[model samples]
Target: MVRAGARFMATGPAQSFLRRYGWRIDRALIKATKGHLSMSMVMPEVLLTHTGAKSGQQRSTPLTYFTDGGRVIVVASNYGGVRHPAWYHNVKANPRVTLTSRGYRGTFLGEEVLGDERDRLFELATQFMPNYAGYQKTTQGRRIPVVAFTEVR
Candidate 1:
């Protein structure tokens, strides 16, 4: 098992600084660390690969995903920032995606949940990490989005 606290200790400073500067330093750290921090702290079960909506380029992001029956749930809080994250926009443009988890990698279909479904999933996710509640409070009016990715084929 990876020590979650240790991973946070490694990236906490950078994350905090970036949060203040209105930049995504976490992405840089994740890329530089090659998923080490995510593996250690977040226990990320899925790495989402989304094609750029306009450019059609491939973009991959490691996210903390949780399995709910047959679907995979991912949060789009972006630490409750004013703007949506790049990955969120990528998924919005292209609903098809790929994911890797538990040494398994495969293609999947993605979609944003709606209404009660989204609320329920958000509640479930908050149970896993209560900090999400604090994250929600950081935003002014935009409600954080929760996206669901389901296996295809």
Candidate 2:
């Protein structure tokens, strides 16, 4: 079921649909479930709250994520869109973020992974979600950005 959903979401129409409205739907569901659930239930999800790069207002985005030791890894694939997702810009502007995942909510520091470390994390992420490779292929050569969020204590 999860694989089917991933395949469906990788389609052009589904990608467009998700880019248009997936975040809003996922945000509500994640919040309502107190972070225990989301549209990508089996795929580990998180609600990332960040200060908007332009508006400065707080914005929340639900994203598929993977755990890397003590950090949470998320990709700004935007479903293979040519442009990076807005949240990526927000995180770049404000490294401080809040995340709600798997019934846990906390403040975190977001860092953009790069170079060999980025490559390693991306490979790990791809192993967890093979659809990411297809997403990368559709990206028209734009290397997707990966962000790691470490809980801020």
Candidate 3:
């Protein structure tokens, strides 16, 4: 049932609604629980904080993430939407980021991965949540970005 619902939520109005409100609820839960929870019924989630590109304001986004060799990976699929997520652009403008995950918080430098690296990370992300495949399908010609966040000293 969860898988079926996940497929349904991967596109159309269901996804739009969830995209509008789901992250807000997840962020609240993370704040309340101190990162014990954010993404349930799915892969690991992180609360990523970054400086806005234009506003220079701090922004926080809850995202499902995977890890490779201690580096955090996140996708900019934006539910297969044509436009990228705001956080993606933020990280691009300023790679330094602060993230909270699994009850722990740390700082990192975000970088967009491409070529073979993106393909590999995308595979891992898809395995974590099959819905990402649907996201890629919906985005058409646009290439969804794969970002890696390595810890900052």
Strongest candidate by TM-score: 2
Candidate 1, backbone clash total: 0
Ranking of candidates on TM-score, top first = 2, 3, 1
lDDT of 3: 0.85
TM-score to native of every candidate shown: 0.77, 0.93, 0.90
For every model in order, what is the number of clashing pairs? 0, 0, 0
Candidate 3: tens digits of C-alpha lDDT, residues 46-84: 999899999999988888788898899999989888989
Cα deviation of 70 in candidate 2 (Å)?
0.6
Candidate 2 lDDT tens digits, 53-150:
99999999999998898999999998878889999999999999999987999999999999999999999888777788888998899999999999
lDDT for residue 52 in candidate 2, whole number 0-100: 97
Better of 1 and 2 by TM-score: 2
Candidate 2 vs candidate 3, TM-score winner: 2
Weakest ten-residue segment in model 3 by summed lDDT:
1-10
Q: Which stretches of candidate 1 lie over 4 Å from their true place?
A: 1-14, 17-37
Shift of residue 81 alpha carbon in model 1, Å:
0.8
Error of 1 at 74 (Å): 0.2
